[model samples]
Target: MKQTGVAILGAGRWGKHLVRNFLAHPDACLVAVVDPYPETLAAIKDKYNLAPEVRLATDWESIRDLPTIEAVVIATPAVTHYTIIKDALNQGKHVLAEKPLTLDVAECLELCHLAQENQRQLMVDHTYLFHPAVKRAQEVVHSGCLGDLRYGYAARTNLGPVRQDVDSLWDLAIHDIAIFNHCLGQLPVQVQANGRVWLQFQKEFQVSQLPVEKEFQVSQLPVESSEDNQGCSQSLTPQQPANLPYGNAKGEQPANLQPANLQPSTPQPSTPQGLADLVQLTLSYPTGFQAFIHLCWLNPDKQRRLGIVGTQGTLIFDEMVAQAPLTIQHGYFEQNGSTLSLLVNIVKFLISNHLNHFIQYAIAFLTVSACPNLHQYLLVWVGAQLVQILSCLSQSLHQGGVPVTVPQLPK
Candidate 1:
């Protein structure tokens, strides 16, 4: 097999995992690892025992133009995505960007157009969509095994590694939203959201109610540390993450890394002044299916769970469950059951364990390199669609939980 030469643009937590997977793949030749932090690159090099033939650099440009490098894997901040991806596509390098494609929908579409024009494959690493469990859930939901769709709910929360560049809505909600759209088979048309900013902004929760009365409450906890990508720095600093090329202590861009013609005159805010640690989202699909998502960075209860309730039963995808991460319970509803009781919920639930779907993601890029047309360009569209929903959700959340309509993708 002719190896596809690849370079990883960010070697942070998530990017390092990409590095590992790409290295393990027989068809991928990882030629370089790029990040602003030298220590991060050094750590990756030492950790992987990378060959001297592979390049390591602080700037992607230094290595991107290499003759051997045919593609770039981008796992940088949302703010930097537009500039870097635009550059990569313009240079005719196939790109595998991290989620949200870009913070803006227009940028995403532009990149999509650019990729098509350049005849290059542009994909986003929406890793959750690659999960075997999610794939199984998709089969169950699409096969009508779950019956008439009623509603869906997902909760993603963590104690720390909260990012300083973007909020939980930007960081955590994308995973669940991607899953929701995939299983539901359509993008959300409308969104109603509100958020609480505590760890980053320290603002009081501007409480709002969903149409239906909800009965739940969580005690807020606060922590101060800036870290993490698709999910960053060894020391979680402000905008100065270990993976991105953020300027200085004051958050200025280095002259070398400044956006050229490819960048927008005014880039979107890297960190919102009202950045929320917790966000409540209600996504309304065209089929009248609504999925509620709870996103939080201050909570210690590490949860990666999503459920779609149909007339027959619910399809549950819970990563925390070791035995069976994906399951479908047939016939009837069970309510008011404590979270712990779910472990012993009888023969009705908990599907078999899934393979490491994260590695499967690496194979996606290699496959794209081999056959761009057969490559599921839907992944790119899905990434863009998620960004569209997120853009609407951001507006609605900041407006005191008012409902916002998610935009339809332009033809």
Candidate 2:
């Protein structure tokens, strides 16, 4: 097996998972690890039991001089992703970084263009996509078992893994968002979101007197009124907000709107519901296919589940517990008509074949040879989810819960 010398950046929570996975892969050789903090680097090194020759750097600069590093896996903050990945691509190294590409769209486009120009592969480490169930779901959808995909949806939620750098969408929903596209065979036409901002006004408000409604102002778009007393009303149209400045917009009021007043509305503010981290989206295609995605981080049961409903049949994927294989249902003849029955246990099938397929595709791409019949349509579908995520978030903030149109990918 040809070993690819790989370096891992960021030894935080997710970094450890990448390190362990890469170490297990026969085709990958873990060469260097980088992190700014001494403690984090030390913990990973001690845990992985690395040799003295395995370079550990407190800064990215130290490893730049190493000519042997063939690829870099960036597990750093969302803010630094573009710079690091751009530098790596510029140096002609392959990249397998985390999602959201960049916190904003411009950087993402720049990275995408750079990868194409350099002929270097830029695979986001959306590990859920590699799951057997997800692979099976994609297969059924593309293989015509599901017929024409009518709609698609997914849920990825958890109580406490929140980060201030990116919202629930970038942090958790990106996984399902990516997978939704993979299974549906289209990009989202529109995206909108509804979320709460705990610290919108920051220290300006007497936090004690503030009603939860005012505290949890929808992050979509601001409500505008001729008068403040008329009650701030905004439309939640479904259009994804692109290139959001990372949490830096705090304390600033929504455009054309004033800072929220702490006084409760008439009839008293409703009992403060827990934080709402839900993002719902829809997509439309010229071919008449539609996709809807609902992602909530508030679910007590942190399961990653998706359902693809179509004309002929449906494909359901459950990623709640590890090792639970994807179960498939296809149309079958009972006595006189059609009935649904299990076709395959997806988990076992994928665990046995997905990586091998990836390896074959990679080799084919490098050798300029005809590759095995695998589904690249999944990539086309994922692109749609990314667009819808931004569109829905934009609409949910301004419009009163309406679906927005997603921009079409350049043909």
Candidate 3:
């Protein structure tokens, strides 16, 4: 195997993981780790025992000046992707970048074009597409076991934590969008969606009927109660919560509460109830195959599950199960609705229990094998699917639940 010198930009969480993986890969030489944070650079140097020759630079100038650095893996923020990737390609280096190639569509297109102009490979790190269970599901879908593709749905959500700079769609939903595109091999024609911001300084919620009823009741609550006092209760339904003045008077508007005084009492509209803290987005394909994606940052469980339904059968991939089986249901909805069955066990093939199945697959194909071209092609698929998913999602956020068409990259 020919050794390729690789440099990792960003020593943050994901960046460190990439650094560790590349350091362990026999075919890769860890050229450097770049980050602006001094602590991050010191931590990487101490934790990984980086060689003296492996330069740690805080700026792009130093990175470009490194001797014999042939490639760069960018784990920086989306805003910096266009510049960094453009520079890397211009330098005649192959590149792998994290999702959301760029925050702006025009910039993303420019980056792609630059890569082509330079004849450099521009790969996106969409981890899910390489997942063992997802891979199994893709194989089954292509095998005709699922019959004619009908509709596919997925949800990735949790309410426990919110991001500072990005929305639920970008932070989490992007993963499923990539998977959706990968499974369907096409993008949605149009997208219309509604979103709400809650629990953050900035909020963008969907406009819905629930807000009308809530606003009516909040107006009836104590006039002095600041909206902040009502912020915690915003998650409540029309039925007033306990310990609040509105709870005692059911179905009766408080007589003392006046519309004028209601100015302070009237709550600011936030996200909608039952909107899944995340979302369940439906993607329509020209072939009549529909895909639904549900993502949440609020679910109590830490599990990623995917289900694909076709005209003849169904496929389920759950990460929690011991074997993480890629179960298939064939002849579904038949005379007896066919039968429930476990089709295959793809998780065991993973290199270890600690590493994710997808990472293992990438490592296997990229380093421990002779399938360089094959692995490169897979990276391209991951990148293109990611671009489509996010594009549709952006459309959905702008439009009102209108379907959006996903675009394809030129071969």
Candidate 4:
């Protein structure tokens, strides 16, 4: 087997982790570590005890044209992703970028076109899509075990770790969104969101902020629009659901399921804050399934929860809940109107494999050596779907929670 030559750009908080992993992988030959901060590079080199053959550089230009560097793992800020990734893909080097591929949808589309043109791999670091629990949840959701799926909800909240570059919605929301899209096997046809702003644009801060998140807090999941999936409308061209971000290597779309209609909602003013300290969103799918999402950084009680209510039971994924990370609460007893007697047992799916999600992602990346088409796998498609969703949701959030339609991606 031939080794894939790789270069890791940015040796910061996340970049260092990539250095450690690539050093251990049997198929990856880490050729260089690039970052503007020299001290950070020195620390990683000393910490990892990198081989002498590895090169260190202050900028990508020094190594951009190097033939030995076949791939680049970028962990830089999102704002800088387009330039670096564009260069890498153009140079015929495969790329593995951090999440939210770019700040906008246009750039992602352009890069997707470039990757195809060059036949170079471009993947995102959406590790949650490869999570053991999420993988199981996807199988369960698509297997029809849940019976007529009713609706869904998820919350990704924590206390601190905010970033100024992007807002809480942009920073945190992609993870849970990726999970929902993966499990449900469909993209939200429309989304509606409203937020409250406090720390970012209050008496002390400026009001000229765009999509704010005080620190770097990324809310887990969302596809929320309208009230309980009402008020939004769409005339379906009757197309197959967009490809799941983590679908098969050939980029196959989901089963041919008839999608729902999307009605547009008037943009209405929700209580005006600055950048929302909290956000409430709803996602309406083609199958008429709706999902409500709660996002916030001010809440002290941290939570990572998502669930799908079905005719049989509710399948849940609560990351904070240690004992039973994934479970199903059967509503087997009896039901009266909306109320139900839940005198039933809960089914737990404890992930026994101790391998971390990133490790799993790395294994997938390495597999690209044998399977070139693997680039079209998981994060590549998932990242695009997420960026598109986030881009659409941003409009709804800024316009005071009007339902906005999510456009279909090119197949």
Candidate 5:
């Protein structure tokens, strides 16, 4: 096999994982590792025992124009994705960028156009899409074993590694969004989002060692009580005034015991302008399938789990479950002549009209089930999706700058 010369940009954190994977692949040749930090480059070089042929550069510009390099794997921050990917594509190099192709949707579209024009492969590193558990789930869905996918819910949370540039949505939920799109074989038509700011600090703050009462008092409420006061009943009641204009016989306000005007001794710095630490998003698909994603950076324990619900069965993928990460519970409801006979009759009538459609669906289900290698088919399916996007973009390009219909899966 002809080896593809590849250069990896950014050598810190996740970049090192990409470096190891690319190096392990037989078809890839690590030509260069680029980063602005010398310590990272030195660490990577020493750990990987990089050959003299592999060039280490402080800037990507040094390797972007090199003809020897046929591909660029970008693992830098989301903000730098646009410039680095655009430059790599412009240089006729196949580009694989980390998720959220670009911070802005317009930039993402432009990069796709550039890649199409250059006839290069433009892929986003939705690593979960390649996971064995996720692949199995996709197979289960495609096989119609779960019947019709009604909805999906994903929760991805961790305690630390809070990013300042992008919020929990872009940093964490994007993975689940991509996975949902890939598994459902469609994109969301509408999305609703809600988020909250739990922490004002830019860096991750440790709350494990600090006393819970003290931390909560400092961050959340202005509780003016001594450490000896174990509960609110002990301290809050005595702090109330003995007599009040709108107080009851017990001297407590009829409405509620409102806290006095208590403020922090020192005003904490304002929260930096950045993404939210907690975000909840609900996506609606044209097929009437809905997905809910919950992401948080301040969670006590790390969690990565997805649940898929259908009429026939339920599928769960719990990454934390080491013994059995993927599980399917068979379930189905049979409609018979009961108290709700009228509803059952109506459902039967509706299903009768769609007999032909159901037959075609059944054929597809059997075809998928008969396939010996589902993983290969999934790869081809993903590739086909990419090709479809490129084809649409190429048509748009030929039509003189009309907008291209980008696919739902980030890239």
Candidate 6:
């Protein structure tokens, strides 16, 4: 079996996962790893027990010219995707990049053009698309079981792992955005976003421990309207106020918020510039379908779930605690009818669906309990999906860049 030689461009948290998957894949050879941080490189090398033949470099240039490396997986920062992808494509290598493709549509288009010009496969790692739960949800949607998709709600939130490079939208919401596009079979025609900067620094940094500064903290800063509010309202046709503040619907600051005072000689802590810790987005699709995404880095509990409401019924893809991840509840209520009839139908729908769901849940739990390696099975399932994506990219490249289909917002 011929193997496609692949190099990884990052060795951070998610990057390391890619490295493991690539190493485990039989059709791919992990030829190199490129990261500027020595600790990361050392850790990956030690963890993988990388042989001397597998090159380890501090920069992409070292492996870009290597003939053995036919492809590159980019798990770097969003801001650097365009440049790295361009360089990799220029080197005649197929590229698989992490999501949000690029911060700008023009950059994404340019990368697509470069891939076409170079006859190399260019794909984004929209990992959720390959998840069993998301795939099942897509199946349910496309099967028309959830008749006439009306709207979707996706929530992806966590307490920490806050990043400085990108806001919550780009960091977390991008996953659901891709998932929404996948499930709906189309991208949004318009997007409206509202966000706030909550924790400017890491949680461990205490206000009392910090040298007092005269500058007001972000929490104490007065709320202001987002610059995009007016345009977003007009373009996206938002039902709610486009400029609403993060934690409050009324846009009022917390009552306990107070300004910080410090000495002139106090050392200032570095905070991310123009990055939001919480973001809410409304995406309107051409098919009259709407999607609401709520992203936060300050939540007490982690959540990864998506709910789709349709004319027929509602489907919830709760990735966190769900046994099957995809749960379908059948039947809908009629708004215009006799009050007694409406009440009877509602009661019947609830009783029938709840009883059916309980039976399914019980069976699912028993099956899972019977399988000792269920967790490992899930891991392999995910890995198989990744391998399938790689196979598609390699085949596409062999077919002279057949133009891999990607989700694109309607223009």
lDDT on C-alpha atoms for all candidate structures: 0.67, 0.52, 0.56, 0.67, 0.55, 0.55
For model 6, what is the alpha-carbon lDDT of residue 47? 95
lDDT of 5 by residue, 333-397 (tens): 66576532211111100111222332222222222323234333222234334333333322332
Q: What is candidate 1's lDDT per residue for 213-264, written digit by digit as tens?
A: 1111122334333222341222224334444442212223233332242121
Candidate 3 structure, TM-score to reference = 0.72
**Residue 274 in model 6: lDDT:** 43
Q: How many residue pairs clash in each candidate?
A: 2, 31, 37, 31, 0, 3
> Comparing candidate 1 with candidate 2, which one achieves the higher lDDT?
1
lDDT of 2 by residue, 97-184 (tens): 6554555554566677787788876655445566567777787777997666677666655443222223444445566666776665
Ranking 1 against 5 by TM-score, winner: 1
Per-residue CA lDDT of model 3 for 196-242, tens digit only, reads 43323233333210121122232333322111111111111234332
Question: Candidate 4: which stretches are off by over 4 Å?
Answer: 202-273, 331-333, 336-339, 352-363, 366-379
Model 1 RMSD in angstroms: 9.4
Give the range where candidate 1 is weakest over 10 consecutive residues by summed lDDT.
208-217
Weakest lDDT window of 10 consecutive positions for candidate 6: 228-237
Task: For model 3, state the Cα shift of residue 300 in Å.
Answer: 2.6
Ordering by lDDT: 1, 4, 3, 5, 6, 2
Residue 28 accuracy (lDDT) in model 3: 77
lDDT by residue for model 6 over 1-411, one digit each (tens)?
577788888776566666776776666788998876566689889998988899988778767899988878776644456678888888887777665465555566567667657776666655565566665677778999767888999888765444433445545665676678677766555556655554443322121121111112233233333211111101101232322210011232233333331111222222223445666667777888988888776665677888998877777876655445667776766665655222221111111222233223222222232323222222212222322232232233223334343343222
Error of 5 at 117 (Å): 1.0
- Candidate 4 per-residue C-alpha lDDT over 1-411 given as tens digits, one digit per residue, 9 for 90 to 100: 688889987775566667877888877788998866566678878999988889998778888888899888877656567778898888888888877687777788889889878887778877766667877788888888777899999997766443343455776677777778878878999998887665444222221233211122224422221111000011111231222111001111123321221111232245433445577889999999998888876566677899998887788898777656899776554878988677656889877542355655665564464334224444366677888998777778877788999999985
lDDT of 3 at 345: 25
Model 3, position 63, has a per-residue lDDT of 70
Off by over 4 Å in 3: 201-277, 334-385, 407-411
